[model samples]
Target: MALCEAEKTFVLHGVEENFRIDGREREDYRPMELETDIVSHAFGSARLRLANTDVLVAVKIEVDTPFPERPFEGKLEFFVDCSANATPDFEGRGGEGVAIEISNTLSAAYSSPNVFDLKKLCILKGKKCWKVYVDILLLECGGNLFDAVSLAVKAALWNTQVPLVKQIDIDGNNVEIKVSEELYDCRKLDVEKAPILVTVCKIGEHCIVDPNVAEEQCSVGSVVVAVSEDKFSTILQTGTGSLHMSTLVDCLQLGIKVAQRLDAALWDTLTLECYTCSTTEDESDTTCLDNPSGVVGGVTDCDKKYCIIVRVDYKDPRGKLASILRSCVDKPTYTNDVIEDETHRVYYRSCRTAKCNGGSGRSDSTSDDNGSLGDKSTIYCPGIGDGAVAVTVSFSILLFAYAFVRYVR
Candidate 1:
């Protein structure tokens, strides 16, 4: 979608006033919805919806021979596919250029060992190692592709569960490595210091962090800065326009600050998503969602961070609420009730295994009001079950009395 001069000016004026079209500040980002394990076939997968932009990333691990030059390190490759559904421009081979650009940018950003350690994926020094393939699918493009893609990739990696190596046997020229067969018995990637790419666009004299479709058209040039920890991992100049040396420095500074904020926010969101959804093989089991460390009901009262409960209404007269809940959440959940009032309703509570602090670090054994995990009892609403049982018993007694009276007569 092309923005006219008048529309561009409106966006520029809003930036100047620190109020965007969506009523967000210059540094503020649009509301984001993130879900992990969306792709059952893939080892680790995540879907991130950033306003109008939607991105899905899946991580697949394969065992392959390590490079002769870098015998100790594993391999990380990125492949991007821009679906035609996102835009007509991406039809057929039309999106190949954009896809290549995105893939190359991600490859460069993650090339540094400090950003992602490849040594951890090694099985046998030079013979065998895990090759991590990160496949990204661009479902929707609403501008700010670089930022959204990076965030989704990081979240997918965090949600990924790499199998643990139990035993390795090497006989003669043949070498064998045994990985743990248990589903949950896996190792988690240390993505605490993962790099986050932030795109800073030069609009007039000021620079903006996240530019919308209209705002992007008004930019003179844009710089994508990949921030890792306190330093910059890679800086790439995008768009056709040029930036002065001073302007470039200013852009880097803005990019770093914005990336920090973005990284923190991303971790908070990922943790929340992980906490609410259990990574259990049997998602239908309500017992897995129970947290032994906290009070009843998904969210606790003492917890300061607010929990967002999403209510979905489906148009199924037969009421397939259990299947719907299973499709959305991997955690075990019981249907609390089917409201017989104004509407046919099913209520589900978010499950949490451990306490999440909306930050990078999560407690290993702490439980809060949100619920707990690991052999904990599931959240049970006694009133609904008891009432149903009472009604059934009363009906059975009445039927028995009528049958006896008829027989006697």
Candidate 2:
């Protein structure tokens, strides 16, 4: 959208005064919501919503031949798709231009070996390697796409579980690979040094970090800096405006600082004590998600503490066990079965086991199945602590002005 002269002046004046039209200072980011593990079958996935811009990222890994030139390294490919619902310009191939640009920028951002180690994806040097595909879907755009997409991509990669190669057979020119049948036996991608992109828009005489569509229209040009640790991975300039070398230096410094803070916050979010099952309903899904088949489901970290599940049991007449899954429960309830009405001899067991809520409320379960609920609470177990540690742990969910998001991947 084009901004009229009057609207442009308003944004320009705000930047000059160090206040944006949204009332944020030049350095402050819009409050964000991030959720990971949304794709039930994908190795890893995450969705990010920054005010208005929304992006979904999923990572899938496959065994393939390594590049002949870079035999020791694996391949990582990025693809971006813009949804027609995002905007009219994104309808059909209209959004292809934007998608290509974003994906290309991401490829460049992670292209550096130091930023994301491709060697880790290598399974057997020259013969076999893990090719990772990161698919990004743009659900909406409200400006600052570079930053939003980068964060979402990082989250997805951080949660990605690279399959464990159990066996490899080499017969002359033929190679056969076998992966562990255990679903959780995969290794997480080390995204500790993943690049974080921050877009600093040059509006008037000042620079802004998180610009809205209106502010984007008022800008002369923008610089996107992808920061990894204290260094830069890639730098890009957008818009038709020119910037002085000195101003560009300032943008780089600002981007690095913000990227570092964002990185720390994201790490804290992932390591915090929060977990959930891939399924949101029934006792079968409640079993810590360890069992992808049979009596179990899959497990992952909630954006908060414990994922919400409609734990059901034959004992409970209604079978709607109160659960707050994936919203990041403050603490996982190991065993908290409270009796609603003692007159009926009804015993609603909040199993001491983390995953045994019975697909709940069904009259079919014979209590014998109840014994297996919490046996392996160790499955994907992350944070467990006494009351004191939980106090500090509760605050981890709110870091970065973040709101919790829930998805199954």
The superposed Cα distance between candidate 2 and the true structure at residue 235, in angstroms, equals: 0.6
lDDT of 1 by residue, 19-117 (tens): 777776666667777767678778878787777889999999999999999999999899999999988899999999989988898988888888989
lDDT of every predicted structure (CA atoms): 0.66, 0.68
lDDT of 2 by residue, 326-385 (tens): 223433332233334432222322322233333332232312223431111111111112
What TM-score does each of the candidates earn?
Answer: 0.69, 0.69
Q: List the residue pairs that clash in candidate 1.
A: 290-372, 291-372, 291-373, 298-370, 300-369
Minimal lDDT window, size 10, model 2: 378-387
Which portions of model 2 show Cα errors greater than 4 Å? 273-409
lDDT of model number 2: 0.68
Q: What's the lDDT for residue 140 in model 1?
A: 95
Q: Pick the candidate with the highest lDDT.
A: 2
